[model samples]
Target: MKKSDINQYGLKPVPDPKGNSTGKAAGKAISRVVITIVSLFFATLFIIGIFMFSYIMSLRGEEIDIDLHSLNLDYTSFIYVNDESGNPVEYKSLYGGESNRIWVDYQDIPQYMKDAMVAIEDKRFWEHNGVDWWRTLGAASNLLSSGGSFGGSTITQQLIKNLTGESDVSISRKLKEIFRAENLEKKYTKEEILECYLNVVNFGSGCKGVQAAANLYFGKDIKDCSLAECAAIAGITQNPYAYSPMNFPDQNKERQQIVLSEMYNQEKITKEEYDQAMSESENMNFVFQEATETGADDTINNWYIDTMIQDVVSDLQSELGYTKEDAQNMIYYGGLKIYSAMDSSAQEMAENAVANDRNLNSDPDMQCGVYMMDYSGRVLAIVGSSDEKEGNMWFNYATDAKRQPGSSFKPIAAYAPAIDKGIINYSSIVQDEPIPNYFDDGTAGPNNYDHQFRGPVTVQYALQQSYNPPAVRVYQQLGPQNAYNFLTQKLGFTSLVGGGVDDSNLGVAIGGVHEGVTVKEMTAAFQIFGNGGQYNEPYTYYYVEDHDGNVILDNRDNISTQAIKSSTATIMQKLLTTVVTQGTGTGAGVTGWQIYGKTGTTDIDDNSYFVGGSPYAVIGVWTGYQNPSRLRNTNASKSVFQSLMGAYLNTKQLKQFTTDSSVTSAVYCTQSGNLAGPGCPTATGWYERSNMPSECTQHQNTNTTSSRSEEEEESSSSNTSSSESSSSSSSSSSSSSSSSSASSSSSSSAA
Candidate 1:
């Protein structure tokens, strides 16, 4: 033996004297290799076992206890409105209160549906303990081959996910799901798990559970679902949004075929049944449910409920810090009790008033909206449209529709702000003559509705008659930016058009806004007059309680902010009263009640509006074609207002408007808007004591032409009125010709 061949042990190296040492060495090396491989295999298995045990232990502390019996498949929240006695009356469901949502037990579900679900979702659902290892391995293989994740979740595992809300697709989430599924299987029977899965799974478009899906898609109960319908519903479980029959009909039909094929391959359905189902699915005419804009099922014909649901969801998100999805889920499934200020009698009256109006009912395309609210801004009633047809039922014209308010917006955008700023009083004279193009360009100025000018008139008469130029003058005096801020910020008119001061032109005073106004907004704004200048944000629900009877929102004493001086509101209310008595709004007057409001008829008669109310209730009525067409009758809204407000006022005691001490009244010349002289015609005028104007100066015989008072002169008054008078100074001219020439000159100045 050589030194190099000696063992490292520093001992004499021995060899097999038989010359087979190499073979023997090789054989020993192979044996050692085998032993090492076996050891590594066992070590790997031990590590995996430890890891699984730790993972299982990690999930053991997680709260997985769920009250299965307390699960309410038939639970639905309700919206309660006040009855005549002021007690809460159940009006409708918070979630399709009138919709038919059937909850059937596992036995009641059609066998075809069960078969289809098992075949498409998990073929070995019946035999598996809680997971199907074979299917999981196949899924992993498929994932690797397709470079995408695949679902291998058994029905029990899905049930566990639904019950525990552990829906994340991570390793820990998968492990927890497995543990929960096993525990669930141990605690409940296979049939019970299936039942829970069918009842808890989410379908598309806010539909939950197999029963809801069956009704929403087929308009039938689960037990009555045909083979094709069953396959369609079962397929939707994979990707509800992608395979929704209403949204993706072609894709849903394709998925349905896959479900039918799976059932046939699994021998769950006969070949003949599969072929028939496939054929039917190819030409399926799904009776899909009509959903509101918020994606709730809209089987019931109530736009108010739809808007209320949206508002409730918004309140939940803003007031309670819940996500949009969470809030909607709570509304539909949390079984909350919502109390609203909706007066059922008022709602019925509003609806009937619009529906039965001869002007609105004569034209199918004509739509009318009526909204009523108390002085505190609690919505009493809302009628979105006169007709509730498929084409128009979803549009909430009262709150959602934005139409030009015409003169109805004058009080809010102009008079209220001007009065608040002490810039004008009811007795302040505004020249009702043609205004020149104040924009300094070649644009036409505003004209009265009849294209006729009435000389100097009091602010009371200007508002009552809906004189366009007077409002523009007042708006200019208040400053366009100041008026815009007051309207958009102070009064909460969010829908006004234009972004900057440049867009806030004189037209805004006359409702020539980019997106005019809604009936609800107008009504809410008008309520400020009745509420002594306090603006309470209009709301439907007074309070809301969660499923656990915890009060989430209590809006009974909602905060009210001062929009204007109480004296200003009082003076404006007095002026509005005269509108119903002697102005364009006389038709809206109810017997024995002092009604006040302004009438609005837009350019081309596109929209008609009459917004007014007594001290008890403020109501707004709007009548127009949805597509901005010419309306033959501009006073149709007045009629509707008269009908609804008449009924509403008749039910309550005639209440008088409370006068604020700061508001004062004085006798002034109606035509001159000044303190009455011995020979001047006079009318009663209300004014804010601080803003009352000086005694008559413009109408005095000697002072008529001696530089009219600056406040009484129109902001855009040119020498046009004087120039036209000079041309007609000839006595030889016929009286009618002189009148006609003066009118023509005024019209030319306006243009």
Candidate 2:
């Protein structure tokens, strides 16, 4: 009944003749090939596949979890802020910490709020099952081009990532996310997926989700958010830190507009509604509540130490592969030996300075923020209050408060960048006259504080007296891009508002910044001036160790970026000394200390600043009110700084500032701020030795009589002679003091 037909091709095999055996026999031998060889090749492939599959399987973690419950984080971990002797000392313990997340049900979330998020996050969210394959393929292509970076992940995929808290940049991890997202979509409805995603997305400022973010940013629950506020909240999920509403308002406003535009383009809202939302957003004022307290119980940690705890948790999540929850858990249970960057001797001095604030400012409401760091960029001490700290984990003014720098920012944003770029130098002549079109409306130039312009002054003299016009002129020459880069990128100023908020305006050089600068950032920024031009990012911790003494996170001296030339730093260092000795910062000087610094006072006189550097440490002090008002005690910051530095320096063996061989002193005309030629009324100034100033062209061959007459004309409105006399007197008695306290107070009065 069965029929066999193996020879379907109609080929017949027969014995070959001896002559044809070489050709026909070999060709026909292909028919006699065995299965063993075929199996061997496939077997090798199978084995390799098994190895790969096993490796991928190894990388797979626990089943995808979207749970909203808190973790079991226990045990006490020791925190260290450097001791009074400048060594790591135990700060306090970490118990169980409270969570900021408070889950709201899916029904409670407003329809427009949901629309805003879906519009900005995923336009095709409702139509897609899980992965958007077209976009996925484009992302894959980009991934290949970018060499392992995975971009354009869908909302479903983002949810999978958020649930797993895994950011491994590998093909296996991406595939795992894709598979989990597909599974999740298959098991749950789109509403469920959206609910889970909304609840888990991080909105920065310690907010876990929309609910927490609404409470933190708006001082209300998510259900109570206005249409404009909802759009603002939706915008923050992309880049939380840069778009933080309270910290950097101008940047956040731009991001909010993008989100609103996305909603309109997607037909999620009508034109009329969009216009109304945009209008409301334009005038919206965020009711920013102070993140003043944490839920840690029975804590002795100050604001600085509290910041250290937060930093440790962050580093664990980044440097190690812990999630935020896991990192927090490890902070309590991982038995870690965390070391902070604080120097205790400086901390004690800072604390004492704040405690004795009554001596400087009579008003108890006048709060001060102080940041002190060594030349190597180790944050020595940070004080955020004038009164003794009351509650646990209160708001940190030293690091968090963004206030205008006024003239104190001159060295960092204006002169230092100019000097580094060779646009201006220590003794370069700059006119204190009006710069054309200085204001945005092009009305007039920056005026001197005393309402009198001193024509043609040295850079040293201009900075010494904190003149606004010269600083703005120098900033114009150097340009805003240079200063912005130097401040934000090189110096690690994270709070500067970018993206055309008039950051390019000449007013910024005179400290008219919109959001302004922080004391912590300013202190770290000044490290380059005293330490040969390398800018070290300010860090809270040094290194972390596990219970067994194994180094887990080493944060010791991150490779410093060379921001400016060492010669420029050395020259600036000497120029700063003039500010303390002969300039407006005279109140900040301590006897026998190589004190160098600049003073800043706001136009409204609400903020006062004195940022100074000694041989060993650089410190910044800001004195203002909680709700800024006209502060009459303008010298409070300088006085507080003097008291602290006097006590701190008296305890340590003194050291001189590091100088480069390329730095040398020159006699410059106080009227010209240039190399003194014949008949020039000159004063001692510092310059970069390699690029020393040319002799004054205006005064080179002038007769003595005319030179004297010209000097009188310039000096009538300026204090050049008096400044030199005070400088000479201060520099002479600088080394004759037995104690810095007595000498500083006596010299402070004299100056």
Clashes of each: 1, 2
CA error at residue 202 for candidate 1, angstroms:
6.4
Runs off by more than 4 Å, candidate 1: 1-57, 60-63, 66-75, 89-100, 104-198, 201-218, 221-304, 389-393, 433-441, 497-503, 698-751
Model 1's C-alpha root-mean-square deviation from the true structure amounts to 15.0
For model 2, the superposed segments whose C-alpha errors exceed 4 Å read 1-73, 81-89, 96-298, 321-323, 359-361, 497-501, 546-550, 697-751
Clashing pairs in 1: 93-97
Candidate 2 RMSD to the correct structure: 13.7
Cα displacement (angstroms), candidate 2, residue 19, comes to: 44
lDDT of 2 by residue, 1-751 (tens): 2123444434664333566768777766764565666878899999999999987666444236554334322234677776556767676665323354556778999988899889888888898878788778888998788764566677888877655546556777777777777777877888887877787676755565688678777888889998789999998877665677854667778888898999999988899989998998888778664232435334445667767777877887778766554565456555678887877667878888888766444888888998887766677788887866643344577877888777777888889989888898877888878766443333355556655677887787787777777887787788776777777888888776452334545556666665667898878888888888998877778898876789888767478889888988888888888778767776679998899887777665777788888888788998888897767577788888898888888988988887888888877766666677788776777777777877877776677822443224334534542221111111112111221101111111111
What's the TM-score of each model vs. the native? Answer: 0.68, 0.62
Q: Relative to the unseen true structure, what is the C-alpha lDDT of residue 417 in candidate 2, on a scale of 0 to 100? A: 89
| Residue 439 miss distance in model 1 (angstroms) | 7.2
lDDT of 1 by residue, 1-751 (tens): 7655676556666654677988889999999999999999999999999998987898865436785656644347878887777888887664433243345688998889888888998899999888898977776787679955446779987776555543334567666766777777777888887777887765664566778787667777788989999999989877665677865788889999999988998998898888888888878977765433224444453555656676787898788766554465566666788897777778778878887888777777888888888888788888887775332124677888988777777888789989888888887889877556433332334656556778777787677666777887888788777877887777777776343432366666666565567888888888878879988888888899977789998888888999998998898888888667766676788999878887776655767888898879899888888788777666678889999999988888767889999878887765566766644556677876766766775456753433333223432342222111101011111111111111111111111
